[model samples]
Target: MQKKTDFYFTYPPNLQELDLATMVSMYRDRGEPRKAAPGKYLACAVTHKLLKEAKWWFGLYYSQAAWDELLTKGSEGYPLTEAELNLLGLVLSSETPPHREYVEKNIGTLPKLAYLIVNDIKQFGFLQEDEHGYLRITPRGERALQGISRRIYQKRFTAEMLVVYHESEELHRDDDQRNDQATLF
Candidate 1:
């Protein structure tokens, strides 16, 4: 009835560390996604925001690159399908901000899975699509992305350093102590 895992468990990268407000503003400024069916637009908007930020962090300046990378990187946990990638591509590249018609024509029908991605990010304080479809990234998101990665890297590096340090230190353990142990034997 249960299973045991030998590997360590890790939490999903904190969503609170990304930049959400700027992302939402990018959507409004671009003026696209104005047309995905009513409730769907907001969810799309929030998902787009998080994806873009992740791409930026990953060194992808364009949404197309970001979408590809996001989907690839997220596959292990949050798998994104073709339809979702299409929607994200539209939102990320929204120059005139394509409405529902534009998205449908470009990406075909939207799927329900997109909502799960948005909701997952929101659970960690990424953003919530309002009734009007607006989104805002929480401060936690900014810190999580900007700060957590570096901190985690440092922590791992430090652990490794400590191992080396301890090993090196062991080499210097008092020779007299060794002699004493040998004599007892």
Candidate 2:
């Protein structure tokens, strides 16, 4: 039978320095059958894109700082992945025109991935190509980058707090160990 929990977690500051994997492993059930699910995972294992609802579910009121910050801000447009944000930030900081080749050199990604990210940025209207094939960030792109930066900061900060909060808990060890086990609430 599945158990229900109302385990409200609050993240703490100084969380970036903590060993999240170890902390998470501490709660692991070592000997039983694996209970992890494909799409479900602990918050620290941020491998794929996470749902926006996560911000509300795991952060915010659970982490008071996140909650206060949430009240002080409004949402931005569609979120960008880490790669997307990195490309945007690079373009925004460029003193000279950055072409696709330049991005590959600086961003340190495979050429194909760099091409796709550049094109994606253009599709979002945050970047443009000049007659010489140089890339430029538009005014709208600047605004978008700003919004993305803020969004990323909020997510990271809140996640840190959530980890710290969980670290203080007195959790029991069980035998079921799964990385992506969805919580059945």
Candidate 3:
């Protein structure tokens, strides 16, 4: 007679518990992307968030006339003293001619302008102070100015927000599709 062999099954004591934990872990991990492109995602997120906040500020008060005057008449690359910006902001904010006249009177006086600049416009990042205690527009400031100008002139600021969000979504989708296709092979 031919010899017969019998097989016996064995299981780990915690097999069920281990399997459950592994599955839960896998499901949780699968929700997040294994590899996300650097900078692009972060840039998109920040741009979207900031643009939304910026829209409100742009609408509420952006001194177009003052901005135009500064850009066109003021000296480029030369530091615009904090005093100068304070006077400009004051003049722009004034609704009545009398108020504007009063603010304009302080334009030439350094002390008045000094106090106004220290209290108000100095906090903005676009204007940076140099060792000489003078403030100038940074490259970031220039870009911000241009963006605000465009938004004001074009009347498409809200639409631009949607465009940015959609473009980022499309880029992310494309990356996912590419990843999926690569895995298929």
Clashes of each: 15, 9, 0
Query: What would you estimate as the lDDT of candidate 1?
Result: 0.35
Which candidate has the highest lDDT of all?
2
Cα lDDT for residue 180, candidate 3? 100
Which ranges of candidate 3 are over 4 A from the true structure?
1-122, 155-185
By TM-score, the best candidate is: 2
Candidate 1 lDDT at 126 equals 36
lDDT of residue 154 for candidate 1: 26
lDDT scores of the candidates, listed in order: 0.35, 0.45, 0.35
Q: What's the CA error at residue 179 for candidate 1, in Å?
A: 99
Question: Alpha carbon lDDT of residue 122, candidate 2?
Answer: 80
